[model samples]
Target: MAPTAKPLRLLAHDADDLAVLSAALQDAVAKIGDIRWDAQARTLTMACNRFRWEAAKGKSGERVRSALQFGDVAGVQARNLRRDAKGAVVELLSMGFEPAEEAPAGVVTLTFAGGGDMRVSVDCLDVALADVSEPWTTPRTPGHAD
Candidate 1:
């Protein structure tokens, strides 16, 4: 039998960590599974299929349920956030956070390749990513420069 992928749980406490997490989540496909924000809890949770790097198989198909908790969240905004987005296979292109000038809170923006984006306005950066399903082999292989 093929080796099973170990369950992954990652925490992002700062900008650098968030960058790493963003890179890991690049090309991840999401379709509005459990994407929501809790005003009282000050947290934003999203469940999606996150592609992960495998030593033996390169990028593998892995499902991940991830969450970002901003202790001092002020508000949230999104563009093209829809249940019908399921048909388009939104691919995460990049992620970034911008510090606020007037308030303590900042904004974390997740940009998708197909022109959709989700922005999280928060006081601080706190995020986590975890694998929620068994990984399966994919046909995509990593390209070599040389």
Candidate 2:
């Protein structure tokens, strides 16, 4: 049988607020990083500052947009946000995942958000949120071990 993998547990904390995570907030704070995966829990984990962002009203009044910026005024609009009024729609755009816009709820979600986009790992040691297919391989004989 294949070895069973354990789930990843992370922590997301806003240095500024240290409370709730809102799009209005994430857009304001600059740095973001957290531990992603570990055979066991980590000690002295390393994190990097993430892109600084700013939020502005989008084309639609209900929707808010975020842009990634550095140093000077931010110019790149990254993602769009609004409440989930209709059925769920998850989209992959340039900045990050869209529609799943609401900051992860609960301490667990906060931790998971710290993990960032599961599609691409923020850190090398991070594990996938889903099953990763093993790379294709050709059968080998035990003799090949030599």
Per-candidate TM equals 0.76, 0.18
Cα error of candidate 2 at position 58, Å: 2.8
- Residue range 35-117, candidate 2, lDDT tens digits: 22332332222132211122122331111122221111111111222123223222211223221224331111222232232
Model 1, 1-146: lDDT tens digits are 23665766778767788888787777766666556678888777777666665433534443444443444566778797675554555667778888778544578899977577988887777788777676656666433335
Residue 127 lDDT (model 2) = 15
* Residue pairs with clashing backbones, model 2: 10-111, 32-50
Model 2 RMSD in angstroms? 20.8
lDDT (Cα, 0-100) at 65 in candidate 1: 49
